[model samples]
Target: MRTRTRIAPVALAAVLVAGGTMLAAGQAGAAPKAGPAVKATCYGGAKYYTSTAGGGSSNAHWPATGTWAYTTSNCNDINVKSDVSLSVKVCFKKTGSCNGWTSAKAGVWTVVAKDVLHGSGFYLQFNRTSSSKGWIAY
Candidate 1:
């Protein structure tokens, strides 16, 4: 009886140690998987890109000051839309270069650029002669 009890404990401890080692080894050998790709959206003729994942309708209107708010993180795309033909400008910073203007026709959602924005922040401006106009970003 003494021998049997001693052997059982030793065997149990060995098995537990081995199992723990195998678990550690398996985790160490596995490569980390990449995250899901972010989705881009075009609404009412404007484009928006975000790392966040979800589905919903987005409002399309220029900011009250004509400047779109953006984060310091990566910006994946530039989108533009309007009720009539208009020009759009995207800048790295508020005071930075205009990058150039893209012409977007009325009622047509357009992607001016994509995968072009890196980690730098950016904003959008809509150039329209008409009093009625709007745009949005994500």
Candidate 2:
């Protein structure tokens, strides 16, 4: 009778421990939901002179050099580390000599390291010829 009493407690303890372990493992397997991308304003930017002709379709300079303004009210949650660098790209297509970025024409680009952040630079293409690329560092 004493052996039976001891066995019952041990079996109960084992079951409780197993249940707790499973609960922890289940939580670990769940993935966090993705958040939305932040909306940024055109805090400031620079304009570059291009030479081509009818419309500004080409990058003027295949490997052009330029910089744009970026202001993030809150960057606390992003993967951007304290020492993160910056490289912003705007896709504006033209033919020959263009007037630069108009009020319209905007697109998303793969923001990469300008220079400082252990990155070579940012490169993108419009067509086979007119393309834009540059580097940034601090």
Candidate 3:
């Protein structure tokens, strides 16, 4: 009876140790889960793009290098994200008109432009303190 009791406890301990090791190994071998994707809404429904950060206050012009994606549809609004706090706006390509610049906080989505010029193709403009990269979604 003494031997049997010792054996049972030893077996249980072994089983528990092996189970814990397996659980830890499984977790270590598993692939890391990714964060939720950033999504935005547009006319055709949603869009996003990584763009070069623009610095300084410029008017009536979208940076030639700042655009990452383009659409023919009229987007309801423009959202921007950056490493630094900044301002952004949207402009009609043909009409040469632009909405007022709005502030976007660091690493957050800010509705920069609420009204884009209808029936005209549009692009984004940024006025940042630094040249850090940013994202635009609509």
Q: What is the lDDT of residue 38 in candidate 3?
A: 20
Highest lDDT, which number? 3
- Report model 1's TM-score to 2 decimal places: 0.43
- Displacement of the residue 72 alpha carbon in candidate 1, Å: 9.5
Tens-place lDDT per residue, model 1, 91-129, is 655457666678878766556555554444565555533
Model 2: CA > 4 A from native: 31-138
lDDT of 2: 0.31
The runs of at least 3 residues in candidate 3 whose Cα sits more than 4 Å from the true structure, single-residue gaps closed, are: 1-69, 72-75, 115-120
Ranking by lDDT: 3, 1, 2
Q: Which pairs, if any, clash in model 3?
A: 41-138, 42-45
lDDT of 3: 0.58
**Model 3 per-residue lDDT tens digits across residues 71-128:** 4243445666666776777776666787777877888867776644445466776664
Of candidates 3 and 1, the better by TM-score: 3
Tens-digit lDDT track of model 2 for 15-51: 9999999997775554222223231211112123232
Among these predictions, the greatest TM-score belongs to 3
